[model samples]
Target chain A: MQRKLISGIIGILIALLIGALIMLVQGYNPIQTYAALFNFSLFGFYPLATTLRNSVPLILTGLSASVAFASGPVNLGQPGQLLIGALFATVGGLYLDLPAFLLIPVLILLSMLGGALWSGVAAMLRKWFNMDEFITTLMLNMIADFFTYWAISYPFFDRSAYSPMTPQINTNGWLPIWGEFNSNVIVMVLAFFVIYLVFNRLTAGYEWRITGHNSLFARLGGIKIDKNYVTVMLVTGALAGLAGGLVVMAGPHRFLKGLGANYAWDGVMIAVVANNGLIGTLLYGLFFSALQTGSLGMELITAVPREFIQVLQAVTVLVIVAGRGYLDILIDKTIARQKARERAT
Target chain B: MNIITGLINGMISGATPILLAALGGTFTFYAGVFNIAMEGMMLTGAFFAVLGSYYFDSWLMGIVCAIIGSLMMALIFILFAVTLKTDEFVTGIALNLFALGATTYMMRQIFNVKGAFSNPGIVPIPRIHIPLLAKIPILGNILSGQNLIIYITVLVVILSAFIIFKTRFGLRLRAAGYNAPSLDSSGVSSAKIRIWSLIICGVLCGLAGAFLSLGYVTLFSENMSAGRGWISLAAVILVNGNPWGIALISLLFGFTDGLGLLLQQYMPSQFTSMVPYVATLIALYFYSIQARKRKA
Candidate 1:
């Protein structure tokens, strides 16, 4: 835990350093830019509140990736799964005329089902053909992307709106807002606790951990590896679906083209950065959300593109993944040099 | 008669990028890295190819710039995945994210444009225009007036196949993946081969990117590669990294993409655009089933 924390700090430092250099190249004051970014988020309640609202999906998708990764399926299907959720949830909210209370829950459930349906393809492929879930999920993501793009442009095309988006859901289906924060926060928090319990308390969690560590051993120890694999995939997909559902309910209330662009990949990054730990994901998801919104503020103040923040985010992940090994070599070299100097003396 | 000609011609044009990328990835696959950075590298190549061509007024310069641009990205991939020994998948994802952002950012900075750009100053690749072949019937469409990159792609695949099967370096590359420890004991450095494989992979992917922007369309667009790199990787996975297999699979993928374009007039544009992606999934099903049969 200490090492992970230290590595994360180092990763952040390096990520910031890279961002600073880019800022310098672009002739912006890096320190001032970063300061503005923090001030926009921490000093103002609204930015953080809006960030919290935007972060609900990131948190859910991170949890989704964590669940599947814990069970050893790479499950890069979050992007596709989220879109499936959005598409189905949009369909349900638009076509189904239930009371507000019932419709909201039902649309959310439909979204989860949509995610599961898509990820189920990968799970089945893995089970039947021993196909790698990674490739299968990736292929499914493309299919989902094209399929959704087609849907939004065609049948769901909102003639009422000026863009290629579905017609907004009836106001009854909107997630309740609390001040600047959307009511998605309530479900997001509820989800965190539920996932925390599942990770810490459930026997299924133990099975998933074992299956991830060693499939042969897991099988030998009476763990139902195949079933566990599929279940975890479904769980993860459901989490992603929840994210999609919440995204639509949170704002816009429509399935617009490129609604969650780069959002799915952000979740994957968070899960990996957090090492798939529930607490880690929660904290990192919050921090990531803050950074995401902060960068937008920074862009407004410093005239740096938000894309620069993306560059920083990517660098952060790379450094976090590579930091341990690189740091070990650095420490080892230092120790060796000290010992050699003492011997020579 | 025209349909056959159209399909065949479409297949070549469609498959060109995928085949190039798959062939590039095949080298890295033999060297034991999943090399998921192809998508980013190809995108980088595509962007730089256009920039270079637009500035230098030469298609060849565009291809050169692409190779160099992708090589830089590949080096970054190797620095993390090979030298620092980071998780390959994580590094790949990072590379892709960086590529997407960097290209878009640079596009805005350099071209002062967003989304896509094309200028008359940029020269597209010249077609072969084989006069004798043009006189032939339906087959003429397939044989005549193809871009130089298509012929180069065919040659690269053949050469890659030869290098993988007939060369000592190929044997070492395979050993790097299959039995690295043994290869290490035998005085061959798997790391060197892996690095070179990535460099080669980057070059191939660069050509693929160049083909996309310069050969196929003389414009640079944000995310212009449009997941073709991933599609190429899919082809690579389906064929188990065999050059010939990847080539054939890519051709099929290209054909579907082409057919989708043709089918758009008949069907909804949305559904037509989705046809290739769905085709890839179905083709993967058959490929996986074939592998299952072989295993059984």
Candidate 2:
């Protein structure tokens, strides 16, 4: 636990340094960018509120990647599942008329189902045909994008409007916002605790951990590896789908083209940076949320362009990939030296 | 007659990019590294190609710029994957995201354009006339004529196959992928071989990107390769990284993409555009099932 925390801290420090270098290249002092980002998120009420609100969908997507990754299937199709889920959620919200109490849960359920069905294709391929889930999921993302684009362009399209977007949902389905923060934050928090319990405190999580660590060993011990693999993907997909519902019901209350906002990719990055474990994802979510919220202020204050944040984000990813191995080597060498000294003593 | 002509010309144009990218993927796969960065590299190549053409007013300069840019990205991939031993998949995702942001940034920075960079000054590669073959019917139109890159692609395919099957380096590449520890025991540096493989892969992917921008559209659009890198990855996996098989599978993918374009002309544009993706699902489903059966 101590080691993981230290490594995480080190990773953030390295990311900050690289970010500073990129800022320097863009003709802005790194100090100002950091100050703006820190001040806004810490003291500014609006920025803090926005960061919390933005984290809602990210939490779900992070969980989506985490669940499958824990079970050993790299669910790269979250982007597609989220898109389809949002589409279904929009249909449920726009077409159906019901009280808020009944409408919200029903739409959420439908969205989860839509996401599951989308992911189910890749899961089934992995189980029945031994096809690589990675390729299938990646390809399905494209298919889903096409489906969503077509939906907004023709059927769901508001003809009078130039942009490709569906009509707003019935007000009854709209989630209540707390001041500036959307009710989506509540949904995200609830999902996090539920997943935390299910993954950390349950026997299912143990099975998943063992299966991921050594599939053959778990199989020999009489575990149903295939079933577990498929089940996790379904759950993960469902959570991602629920995120779609959150978008429609809690925030936007409408389905727009490109509504997923590349969150699927963002979710994967969060999960990876988090190392697919509990607590780590939440922390990474907060970190990314800060970067995103802070970028707005950075853009407002400097002629440096807000995209310097993206350059920072990209550099963080690059450095993380490059630094992880070296970190591991560093730890190994330190351990080796300690052992040698102990032997000499 | 137009359908026949479309069939031939479409296949060549479609196949050219996939062939170049997949062949690059095969080299990396042979060295035990799944270079997922090909997508990003292709995007980088496309951007540089456009940037070069825009500035120099020459397609030749554009192609050169693309290859160099892609090679630079490949070097970064090697630093992480081969030198540092970081996970390939993670690096790939980073590269894809980085490519999107970097190219978009450059596009906006250089030309102040968003989403696409199109200028009248950019030169697109022109079709090369092959003596008697240019007058021939469907065969001539399809096989004998294309941009210079198309002919180059065919040559590259043949050479790649020859190199993989007949060369000592190919044997070492295979050895490293299949059994790295064994190569280590034999006093061979697995890292060096993998690095070389990635460089070669980089050059191939670079050419593929050039073909997309310089060979086909002449303009580089954001995310233009649009998951073709993944398609090529699928081709590599489905064909098991065999160069000849890579060529054949790429043509198969190219044909589907071509057929989709033709089908769209007569059908609803939405469904027509969906043809290639839907085809991928069906083909991948069979591929997976076959692999499972083999494992059982």
Candidate 3:
């Protein structure tokens, strides 16, 4: 655990160094850019709130990726699932005539259902037809993208709006806010708590870990790997769907084109960089969110493109993954040298 | 007759890039690597192709620059997945993200463009004028006046078949996939074989990218490769790296794509744009069923 943590830190430092180099090459001051980024996004009251708000979807998506990874299938359908979920939430908010308390829960549930249904298709394809979920989910993402675009463009488009977007949901469906914080942050926190408990304390989590580590071993241990796979996929889908739902209820209050943005991909990267651990995913998700929110400020102040953050994030993942092997070699060398010195003594 | 000719011509052009990338992916697939970074490589190639063409005023230089860019991406994949022994899937995902970011960043920095970059100075690949083929009625109309790369893709498909089946390197490549340790014990380094395959994959993807920016269109757009790289990946998976099977699948996909373009005159483009992806999913479903039956 200590070694892993050390390597992760080293990986991050290396990534930052590389980012600095790139900025320097582009005739910007990396130190000043980073300072302004953190100060603008993290130190201020409003900026911190915005960072937290942005992190809500990321936390959910990161957990979604974690759950799927823990169950053996690489579910790359988070974006599609998120969009479907948001679409369902929008439909429910628009058509359902109910009190605030009743309607909000319904919208959330509908969103989860939408996400689950979308991911279920990929799960079913894998289970029945022996299709690889990786490719199927990717294809499903493209389909969902165009399908949702068509849906809002023709069927649900807000005629008064200047851009492509669905009609705004009833205000009752909006997530409650206290000060600058959306109640969706509560949802994110609850999700992390539940996932943490399920992973660390539940027997089902044990089965999933076994399954992901080795299906043959899990089967020999009398676990139903197929059932676990389906259950985990559904759970992950719901989590991702909830993220989409929250994005609508908390911020946009409507389904906008390109609303999914890069959250799903960033979430996947977080899960990978965290080594698929729930706690690690939360921490990394928040860090990535800070960078994301901060990038805007940095861009404004330094005339640096915010896209540099993406390059930084990706390099960080690469370094973390690749640094592990080299770190192991170094550790082994240190131990060997210590043993030789002990013999001499 | 004219419509049919146009459809056939569009199909070939649509399939050329996918075919090129899949041909490259076939090598990596046979070498025991699941290279999902072809999309990124192709995107990088597309961006650099435009950049090179705009600066050098030559399409040939654009192709060279694209190959170099794609090779660099492939090198990153190899370094992590092969040398460092990390998960290839993770490495591929990271590389794809890197390519997207780097390309977008460079586009802004170099051209001050946000969504896309185009200029009159950019030279597109010229079409080949086969006078003899042009005089041959419907066949002539379908085959003549195509982009130069389309013809090269045909030659590449044949050449790939020969390389995979008839060469000693092909034998080692397959061996690397099936049993790398055994191949290692037999004195040939499977890692070396995998590296070479990825290099070849990179080159093919480069050509595929060049085709997209310079041949298929005259400019580069953000994420312009779209899902063709993924479609190429599906083709590779469906055919299990058979060059001819890949070509057949690419043609089918291209046909769907071309049909989608044609149908856009009658339907909303969003619906029309979905034709190829939906078709790919259906094809994959049926292909998996057939494979299952054969196994049984």
DockQ of each: 0.69, 0.63, 0.81
In model 1, what is the error at residue B44, expressed in angstroms?
Answer: 0.8
| Steric overlap count per candidate | 0, 0, 0
Give a tens-digit lDDT track for model 2, residues A79-151. Answer: 8899888889998888899998998878888899989999998898788767788888988888888888888
Each candidate's chain A: what TM-score? Answer: 0.93, 0.95, 0.95
Please write out the lDDT profile of model 3 over residues B54-84, one tens digit for every residue: 9999999999999998999999988999898
Which clashing pairs does model 1 show?
Answer: none
Question: Which tens-of-lDDT digit does each residue in B204-278 have in candidate 2?
Answer: 888899999988887888889988898888888887998888888788888888888878768667666666667
lDDT (C-alpha) at residue B59 in model 2 = 90
Location of the lowest summed lDDT over 10 successive residues in candidate 3 chain A: A321-330
Which is the winner by TM-score between candidate 1 and candidate 2? Answer: 2
What does candidate 1's lDDT look like per residue over B1-296, in tens digits?
77777788888999998889889999999899878988999999999999899999999999999999999999999899989988888889889988988999888778888889899998898899898988887767778889999989889988999999899999999999999999999999999989999999999999999999999899999888777888888888887899989988988888888889888889877677777777877887888889878988
Tens digits of per-residue lDDT for model 3, A161-239: 8888999999889999889877888878987898888877899988988899999999999999889888888889998
- Clashes counted in candidate 2 amount to 0
Model 2, runs deviating above 4 Å: A40-42, B292-296
User: What's the ranking of the predictions by DockQ, best on top?
Assistant: 3, 1, 2
Model 3, position B56: C-alpha lDDT score? 95
